[model samples]
Target: MEISLNSSSNETTLLADDCWEFIFKIIISDDSCYFKSLSLVSKQFLSITNRLLFSLTISTLTPQPLLPSLFQRFTYLTSLNLTRFHGDLNKLLCQISCFPLNITSLNLSAKFTKSTIPFVGLLSFSKKITTLTSLTYSNIYSIHYTDFIFIADCFPLLEELYLINNLCGSYDNFEVDFSDSFTLYKLRKVRLKRQSINDELLFHLFKNCKHLEEAVILGCDGITDDGIASAISQRPTLKSLSLSDTFGLFSNITTHFIDSLVSLPLTKLILINCCKYSYAGIICLLSKCRQSLQHLNLLNADFLSDQHVVEFSLLLRNLVFINLIGCKMLTESALFALVRNCASLSEIKIEIIWRKSVQNPDSLMGFGVYPQLKSLYFAKSVENPDSLLDFGVYPQLKYLYFANNRWLSDESIIKFASIFHNLQVLDLSNCVRISDEISKLEVLNLSETEVDDETLNVISRNCCGLLQLKLNFCNNITEKGVNRVIENCTQLRKISLQFCDKVHNNVVDSMLNSRPSLRKIIAPHGLDLCDKKKKLFLSQGCILK
Candidate 1:
């Protein structure tokens, strides 16, 4: 039997509304700018994009009378950011409370401005919205100890709290009261920055908030190791702790503090600028939590040496991510030890500076391949130009940040392309000698490099899948090179051309017109585009910065 298909009916039958909505959601997940482009397709798409917006940021510049219409249009918003709203915050909060919205996360962090917490408005808002679980109130001019108690009372269901005040020496005069009334039973994560919190406040929190898990305290000089140990001893649920920049002549992470941490099952530990610490104390702490700790960051720990790294790396078998940014004493030996021991390690950020001349740097090479390693931020300086050649290939590595290496050249780029075949993101900023070829990268940053038109042409030919390209301060490249990249890299979404002297306004206009996929363009300073042109670019779903 022969069957004849009706082509006309097949062509006319469209996808269901639900199926289109699902497809739009997946597309926006990768690039939200697609929502703007999709909204222009038809009225159905416009409605769908409006419904998909789950978050909105409102600044003080936004008219108060238009908020109701804006809120009504984006009814699915569950997160509201009011960090830029510097007007009468109390009145704004009362206005938001009247809206029929279920906002779960609210950010009132006045990062660019200084404002006190709107206690009166927050109390009224809390009564209407009990679903808020996260609150971030940072960069306030001043906050009394009573403000924290008031916050706990207002949001009893808050699971995460970030309270950061501007450290201006005003906290010393305020009196703090540690009472049972300050209760946050549901609080699980708390970050206090530049606050004058003492042991009594720490004890009150640990005692009242029974389920606390993560705590980050930075620049709080009043917190002592003994106070932390005593408080942590009672809380077994604590998994992550970060302490940084505790200012005092005698304040530092001592053996006693390390010993206290050994009993807790911490998965993440970050200690930055904790000037005085014993090598033996750190070793003991690592040995105790070897099986549990997965993330460790020891920034500005200049005392760390090659011997110390070799000894402690053995205890980091299950470590996944580690940052040793400012440990100047560490050499290539530390990197070798970590790769040899930590089989599950994926990401590492370290600075390796070779102080002495080596007869044969190849002798420091280690054994085996680490396919699990994907991201590496290695900023190094070595006397030997062939130092990078000794390092073996990372077959599965995708993200590499080898910035500020003056010795990097064409040979190193070629080696990288051959070794990291799956590499997608590469940052070689501040490497003056590199004017070479690269592999098929998604994101490439060659800022402050010596790349010219010839080099860019070679890159545009190879990197067809490039999404973002940053060429800031690359004065050699002209409009010819940039236009080639814009024409060839069809999937390009963002490009930065700040301080490129040879690329003028005509090039910028051509870039906007040529690539329909371009969402953002960081043009050179003083391009002088008119308001009409800017509106036209916005209409075409491209932003000029």
Candidate 2:
């Protein structure tokens, strides 16, 4: 690659003082590179590019030997993202082993096995850090109860922590005690993802963190009826509460805690997997907390069948967001009943479930009442696409998410296309087959899913006002697919291609050069472009690839 040492005649202050400030602004503010590089020039570009080269979030280079260089140069980094950083936790431990004391937010995730993160090593990191505010260290195998007690001893200022997708086996197996309340007193949000958290520890959270608003204790096996009742009765100020994945919810637990929950005045309630309760449980919930519920996600609580849905339809009149994903027992009539009666319902997600498991998959029951519905998330396993006709003519639909279901075909798109003219966002991400019906769409996402260029071009043409287009992992579309859209769609802003094997360097070059309005391009690590060309393409102001 040639590095031009001389300047051109036409060049008139390509990068001024303002430009450098703007680039630094985006780098510090963490704005997408689309607008950031549009502020830079060709000269001294390589030196300035180093600012982006070491961001723990975007960069992929190994940090073993260069850790000190990163720590010394990027001293102003406010947050470090280590969620998907490659290799073992030892590598991860080494990478941040020298992080600057100023970095406040740290997101540690297991890109590898969770077991690698020994509790002692984690406790040391958490213990020493005094300014850390937001932390996500989740699912490092079965974290012993004593490990948490250690964490509570450390990180006196820790506020937000996500413990989702982890295994906390037999939480009652050990006794964990925090010596001082100073550590937990400042924690605002704690996520207990499906672990069996001891009831006493949870109450400790409620009792200490008087300012706690969000507490996610999904799938906590240690939470008995008494524990749940005690926590809510105690923390009356909680705004967002998630009790998902705790399917052990029986009628007795429901009867015990219904009144207790109603009194807490919760705004967000996620009660997925509470399948052990009767329809009366949901009914009692809606009957008591109808006015305050803003987002209630009750996906796949097996016990509440169509009858309970009917009960909820009558009681829940002010619900704004509801997720009924995997509620197989929810017959079409029940679905119809809720959509029809729940006037304030806006976002509803129904996930893919096993059809053969139900006695009757061909019933035409739940297609009744959706007057105020706007955003819908339809799962991948829905067999009959014709079932969507139950939406009863959606003219106000804005966001449509048809997550890959084997049974979805072009016919379904065509049918739903005519109904949702006001659709602003359409996510046919991973459907089995899409016909010409989608060609009429303006906003589409076939990312990490499947689709032919034929389906893509029609969308680019019909949806001239498209804002964000994602065609990632789609193998069928060649440069022709990209060209078809790039040539026509002027308003397109963002495109994501995480793993489309067919995409080559030439297509990427042309897309970057041809589309002037293109702002962001997110392609996962496999674009077969040369080193020189990749640098040249990025300097032109397109985002990650």
Candidate 3:
């Protein structure tokens, strides 16, 4: 694809190098004003937009010669993000010693305080990024253990490592000797948050990164349970293991970590809100990863009951995204045995904390409309909840989080929003007897519901494909139901109206002059609107907090 014509301008053509590298990978932008307006369109579009400006983000309120003129006009940067860099660490290590050391993903973050410790010379410039491979240093103000062993001996072809929530140095009376842990044998994905990571330096950094594949240990309180079952039995290419909120070490070793993942063949296992584990070791780790489990998050597991989540909804059945959120002794026959046996379930998050339905949600009738269910939250039921009104026509239910169902009335939420038909994010927050129908919803949360103004003029005459509307404390809305939802949703961009104190300030200046494509309005502090209407709400680009 070579198209060259530009005989010194006039007919201006020239686009080739693989169509400017596929338009710089489809215009990936960190807003350098779209490559400074296509690099003033010429000199071969400023040398292929400076080789697609391969990622650069220096922030600390920029403009200190904008980080040495963006590394002297982008010489093929390979990802660099020094965001929140709170100034002068020897002028950001003399502008990161004129970077371009072929940076292969380096994100050094910083904000300040904790006695500011922006120790640049990161391992004395790790021989200028010897082809560094992914390093995300987070929330830095302090970090030691020989700066985490000279940034893990300056990335030996490092393969992904994110150390979040920095701050850690005082090795009180010196202890951190994890027998030479700095190993990065081509590391394979490791995310350790809230550091000071222990367990003998996280099992001596996973016994020298034996090709560890995806291990995210959040809130690492020096991980226990035999240092995570000896680093999950030496990662045989460990497949996605996210141990979240890690103190309570998998609720006191859920049956020896499900007998150390009887031969890790895991396909995404996230133990969220990790505490109180072991419902027969989570139904024997879902009967040994029921044929390679597909994303299962026991969110707030509350010791899953109802005959062990109805025998883990008939043995996983190759489950696909199951988040038993706050499992309050799950019933309705364990969500009709997981919508009649997983069946490639797309996404299901439970929680109807009692209120009847030990079974009879029409006795788990025949299972018809699941067909790869598409997101269903259904939380809180406070009695007489008519167990999901005889679930059937799911038709790829598109994001439905029936929040605080207070006896979901209104003809059972318009017969469950009339059988899906491609609904889009309908979160009836605090469902005060669910009002009006969901006309092709597009992110409607009805905050503390019982919507008024005739459900905002029936969501501006049938949800005109609404875009982000919350109505914070629905104090029976005012301002003429937010000017009939900013004059008929007209593609509204964001509205919360917290504590709707009968909204004043001329209904927030006529809903920012009838939504000039509203961008954000949260309200609540009694619409005080002054300082020339908050600089005319930031001069119309909107954002009346």
Candidate 4:
């Protein structure tokens, strides 16, 4: 079970096949496409990769007759996705039911066609595979209200269900009939999006499910705040609730609903594009769930101001993740207040505001280091680049996304990179002013920036451990600069050069010949390879896109 790998020093290192499998599992968990390269390592790796295949996505390209062989080859598949299969779903389900596979999760989201759920086929499939516990049917053209009753009967033990139907012309006329004989007693989480889910259906779900814990209702305008309060009052086990794009909620209505949920120990609440709620309503909810809440997302809530965030910051001491995206009224003061109060906060996302008046010189200065913080996302434009210097370093920060920050300069970039020693992923896409060299990073994105040949040389020298580099719109980088990166960065696996006109098709061959670790190359425009040439690259374990 142990394999020996000879290092460059002629030293033999013995590793168990189980350890290699575990490492491959981690890589595939991040991206499944890496399996192709991993399998090509050795026969031992090929066997390990086969066993690691626990989930498979069956699309239109998948041959119907090859299902049995695929299942036999990888006998541990427990999750199946048929969202893009354009053929007869009924027959496909019946065909798959014959296999002795222990599939627990199934996704039938029809993204290509406007097909309805194959109730007959699903009933047959459920009969064969009683181990199924999760079902998803998103982006389907239409589904009747009565279909829920059939789904309850088909998959009685389903723990999670996602039904995202598209807006149809006859959605308003859908029936609201529920049978008392059928109940989803085991259903714990349900997400209904862009459907005609009215108050009656919502209450029926809460009343029947009994143990329902999380409910996400997005773009459903038929349910009012009163209905939500009444339905949620019935389910004491409900801990997470998400409502998005709901126009029926007002200031008073929202406050009333929040008051009704005071008895429940809610842990997570998300309200997106529901801007009618007053600050008092949000504060009331936050205060009620202050002891238990851990995650809060209020996206596109235009009513949120700095005062609102500051007032609620104290209640969010236990909050781990908070997203305030699209709340245009909030300033840097709101962000600093959360960092000061929320001791356990790990991730923070907020839009940078552009104000005409000059900011206070001491606004962004002197916030103590927060070791718990790991990721930060700042969208839109940053008016003052100098303020970034004052934001202190976070030693544990790994992922930093400052995409679309037009005013971000080299001085701020160098200062920020020097502080976060463990920074692994740095995304400065569309920050056109970033032309300086950064420190060693695993994944770096400089797409749409002014990164030139000199900067690439510097990065190749410093970031030799780079795995993925994206330079899509870096027009100043030519073939010589790219060749230097390919030669120096021996661990580079993926590189993108989509719009660099100076880089031609000849560099593709050089990349394939020079670097055996290269797996994916997004070539520039007007570089179309023939089928034979593409196969040649694939033979060398490189995919040309």
Per-residue C-alpha lDDT of model 1 across residues 1-545, encoded as one tens digit per residue: 01133556752136666777887666557455677777776676678788888888899879889999998888888889988887777888898888888889999865555566788789888988888999998787666668788889889889999988764644554456768778889999999888777777787788789889999988876778778877787777789999886675235666667777887889999887877776766788889999999999999888899888888888889999999999888887787788888989899888876647667767655455677777866765544546555556777887888788888888878877887988888999998999979888999999999999999999899998899999999999999999899989988999999999888768988886788789889889788867887888898889987
Question: What do the candidate models score in CA lDDT, each in turn?
Answer: 0.82, 0.65, 0.70, 0.82
TM-score for all models, in order of appearance: 0.92, 0.74, 0.33, 0.91
The superposed Cα distance between candidate 3 and the true structure at residue 530, in angstroms, equals 29
Query: In angstroms, how far off is 122's CA in candidate 4?
Result: 1.9
Residue 103 miss distance in model 3 (angstroms): 22
User: How would the candidate models be sorted by TM-score, starting from the highest?
Assistant: 1, 4, 2, 3
The prediction achieving the highest TM-score against the true structure is 1
Q: CA lDDT of 541 in candidate 3? A: 60
The true-versus-predicted C-alpha distance at residue 269 of model 4, in Å, is 0.8
Estimate, for each residue in 1-545, the C-alpha lDDT of model 4 and write its tens digit: 11345556433225578887776666557466677766765677777788887789999889878999998888788899998887788888998888888899999866666677797689779988898899998787766668888898888999999998664523564558887776899999999887766888888889899889999988775777788888897898899999886544433455558776776778988988877777777788788899999989999877888888988998878999999989888887788788889989999898857565745755656676677777777776557656655666778888888888887888878888877888899999998989988979989999999988889999999999999999998988899889989999988989999988888779987887798788899999888778887899898778888
2 or 4: which has the higher TM-score? 4
| lDDT score, candidate 3, position 147 | 60
Per-residue alpha-carbon lDDT of candidate 3 for residues 342-438, written as tens digits (9 for 90 to 100):
7887787777455343545565455445656777666664465555556667666777777776777777777777777778887888888766655
